[model samples]
Target: MNKMYKVLATASILALAAMPVAANAQQLPAQAVQKGNANKQTDVKNVPATWGQITNFVHDKSDKFITVTGRGLAPTDQDEIVLAITPKTKFIDAKGKTVPLQKIIDGHKTVKAFYSPNITKSIPARGTALTLVVQDQSFSAIDGKVTEVRDGRILVKGTDVYDKHDEEIWLHFADKATIIDQNRKTIAAGDIKEGMSVRAFYGPAVAMSLPPQSGTNYVIVNTNMEDVNPGEVNELTAGTAGVITDQKDGQITVIGQPLEKGGVNYVVLSIDDKTQIVDEDGNKLTKDALKTSGHVEATYGAVMTLMYPAHTHADKIVVKKAESVKIEGTVMPSDRTSKDQVYVNVGSDDSTANDVILNISKETTIIPALGGDTALRAGTKIVAFHSPVMTKSLPGITSAEVVIVTSDKDAVQPK
Candidate 1:
């Protein structure tokens, strides 16, 4: 019996795939078939690839699959009939996998070619203050929000559009429809507000056009730590302020906070270093992480930064002096050997550059400037101070100072 079922499934799929365009042409005219019309088109040839409908019977059992059998107006080609099912949020796959109501709607199929009005490509905006009469199903006032609406297209962000108590509805926009707000005014999208009432009109039911199979899962990294080390993992509390920017098997791009002008940048840590991150439940994770904006308190290791991680064979990194830090000095040659470190000469009076080795964190490493010597020249004046020495090593000054190129008294003009 199992083998027979597999064969039937394969045959059904093949029949649906092989359906010709001519078959759909014959049934387009009979779309207005009344609910109880005896002459309703039953043939699978008349149905479009996408259609919609609600379930006549709600199944409550270990196997949540519904046995859908409907009589069409005409005899449909064996594979021409398609059946799509969308169950409540509580529905789960046979494998015990959690299935969102949206996924069920997207994967619905028809047993015969004639389209089902219940399974549609368009989803309606949600609302609990209005009446929704589509096909033979009538749903009274349901709470929902208009997430998107543009030219015959609309999406609702709320629960209970479908059988699922918390499922949202994605419907098409209808310009001719009347929307009477709570204030009793027929307003536009701009006039929409919280707790507004809504309703929708329909032409033909549409369904999402996608392959029969499913896709793979994508990764996303959302954190609160900003100015973070390039590869160091940081902890970001869960909030709308966080976002995922990149996706991979194990890693994803995330961004937070808005960029400010003339602001400073700092590094929290580096890559290949493990830090403690936590899931929503407060469980910790030891992994590499990155952050774009917001505040995150985490312990991370130093890895390659936007610049050289350190003074190794990697390319040189450019370090800019902050305005608050002053620079004044005369050119003098000195030697130093370190891959990720830079040696700068500061006058005794210089407060910022008093420190020899500036730690820019593992994310950023100091390298020789293009066509420049290894050590800072005597005449090169620099202002520096300690900040978040880990990632961004922007100098901070305790006292204002300056460094400038100097010539012998005999070679300089008196001011």
Candidate 2:
């Protein structure tokens, strides 16, 4: 019996060795197992992150989600996915500062998201977002002529080299939008005017309006006007008409028609003893006759300052008499033959139907209550001075001698 037991035990041991050695029995050491387990945990923690542009936001009472584009698990995977936002999710900006989720959405910023490897088996996989890093704001530049300068916006008409097309864009100035001269010196939005060349940096998102619109980041006014050759003689015959914007201590600044065709919208005229100040009838007048908001025609010499609104000695200045008719009303929307004109509703409301079409020519003076010339657009309240002799039509058409912007309600409001 003892011999049988020994044989049986040997047989058992032989069978165990001959049979598959239950893999675990020949397993690696505890340290190796621990290392393996640690590696797996590390893998779970180090799942590859996917980056994409935030296309849209989805929010409700109990949940928040964001749609991300240009990201996928594989190279051939769909480019968009829906990411769930949890309380533990963190939002970081390019500056490494923590920001609210709304800020990223409002900025329409791109982001990199860290999420779990597990995702829904949907066309565009849905996953829980662990963290999101907001990318820096990317800016695009548009350089062109300023077609219009409204309360807090400007229309730029020029060629877009990237798009390879001519575009007119209305750029809305943000509260922090910087306006600088060619020298990088800070300037005011009012300093910008139609007909001047400018370069503006703005965001990628553009509003689909009549002329595309975008929020401007910064603007650099091209103060470098084409220099006149010394050899070329300037015909002292250049003439301009507009309203006197500034007059003090024998110096007058006029905002009106370009000194020459296709020139700047303003000019600085230096008055001296030889300068002739007169009225339309050629009656002599003192230098005091040149007043702010007074419509006038000016003739200047060829020699002028290099700066825009070129400064020069005035050979003659004709201050026209004040318009006899005065109309106070809100600027209304109407079909216009030119961008230089606006339709004014004669009363406090549009119900009056008494629309007066004010043609804004180079001679019209636009005066903002805050002190500066601005282009007139719809929704502005103004007091327009014009001649009583208007076109005999349902809506009288006349030239606007002076336009006073009484309300700045349409002005830009910072976000």
Find the candidate with the highest lDDT and give its number.
Answer: 2
Candidate achieving the largest TM-score: 2
**Model 1, runs deviating above 4 Å:** 1-142, 193-204, 209-415
lDDT of 1: 0.28
Query: After TM-score superposition, what is the CA distance of residue 239 in candidate 2 from its true location, in Å?
Result: 4.2
Tens-digit lDDT track of model 2 for 281-396: 99999987887767788887544543333577887888898533667898876665357777788886746457788888766656553222365767788877776778987687
* Cα lDDT listed for each candidate: 0.28, 0.62
RMSD of each: 27.2, 27.2
